[model samples]
Target: MSLSIKQQLIAQLDRILSAKLEALAASITSTQESRDSDTKSSAGDKFETSREMAQIELNNLENQAEKTARMLNELKQIKTTSTATIGYGSIVNTNHGTYFLSIPYGKLQLDGTTYYVISMASPIGQ
Candidate 1:
């Protein structure tokens, strides 16, 4: 593949990460608002339950946001220039399939060819 292919892949991953982070932030904000508004009504048990659920959801969303941010950082660190060896930012084309050693984004299609974007820490990547 050419440098442009890697650049395009990086751009796609960046967009995906940004959109995910944005959605997670929105969800976290909404959950926080809902939890804050859950005042102690006449039914204290119900209020507590609602608040707890919101808190759990907020925690999950926050975790996802952090992970997405990390992915964005990793993507930013990728160099589009070709490498002589199979390593980070390397694009490997085999008889079985093509692989992009970056983040674990599963499968991505570019110019009719499907590429697997995988992290170095992943089983296949290792």
Candidate 2:
């Protein structure tokens, strides 16, 4: 049995998300180290400025991590098999067009046939 297009997409997204999350984690760690070092050497205005910058960076990383996590959850919720409704992860086929539920990437093979990869937000996908 071949993996569905949706499954392939989810796998790709998962890989991307995991790498992103790892990078974010590394950023958080580096930020923490900088904050610690600045606090030890600086005082008054300089210390406050460094602290604020670090906090802002941390917040941004947190927000991005949250957004990525939500996207992953949404992908996980997508139904693999549907009669013909277009939704996230739906390999849609219509009289007017055909689309695979995938990230905007190159050709993908499923069951020995090539599919045009398209993200859920693509013009043809919507």
Candidate 3:
């Protein structure tokens, strides 16, 4: 069956988030491998610096993965059906643009129409 605009938007978000999570996982894995393979050379300071850098990168990637996972969970909770009041998962149409109150991902274009996917916490969403 054909999906509504909201459903389509949710699907798109899922795809985006899933891809981001995968990429982050790959990055984390690569960083861990690099750090593990790092050998202590004559220059101990250089080796320590490399390990520290890798750890920092891994930490950042892990944090991003956690955030993306939370966003995916949020998207899964969204109901695509129309709502009487504007809130999360509501699709708003205005003269300026169409907005989907789902995540912070911005500027979605579908079927020749533009949609601004915004989080309620954002200034514009407020």
The TM-score values for the models, in the order shown, are 0.95, 0.67, 0.93
Candidate 1 Cα misplacement greater than 4 A, ranges: none
Q: By the lDDT metric, which is better: model 2 or model 3?
A: 3
Alpha carbon deviation, residue 26, candidate 3 (Å): 0.9
Query: Residues 90-126, candidate 1, lDDT per residue (tens digit)?
Result: 9988787899999988899888989999999998788
Misplaced by over 4 Å in model 3 are 1-3
Q: Quick one: best TM-score, which candidate? A: 1
Residue range 1-126, candidate 2, lDDT tens digits: 134656765676678777888888898889878877775454688778878889899889889887777766765776666555556666765675456665565465555656666677777877
Per-residue error for 2 in candidate 2, Å, reads 8.6
lDDT preference between candidates 1 and 2, better one: 1
Order the candidates by TM-score, highest first — what do you get?
1, 3, 2
Judge candidate 3 at residue 87 and give its lDDT.
90
What does the lDDT read for residue 10 in candidate 3?
90
Which pairs clash in model 1? Answer: none
Deviating ranges (above 4 Å) for candidate 2: 1-3, 40-43, 93-126
The RMSD (Cα, Å) of candidate 1 is 1.0
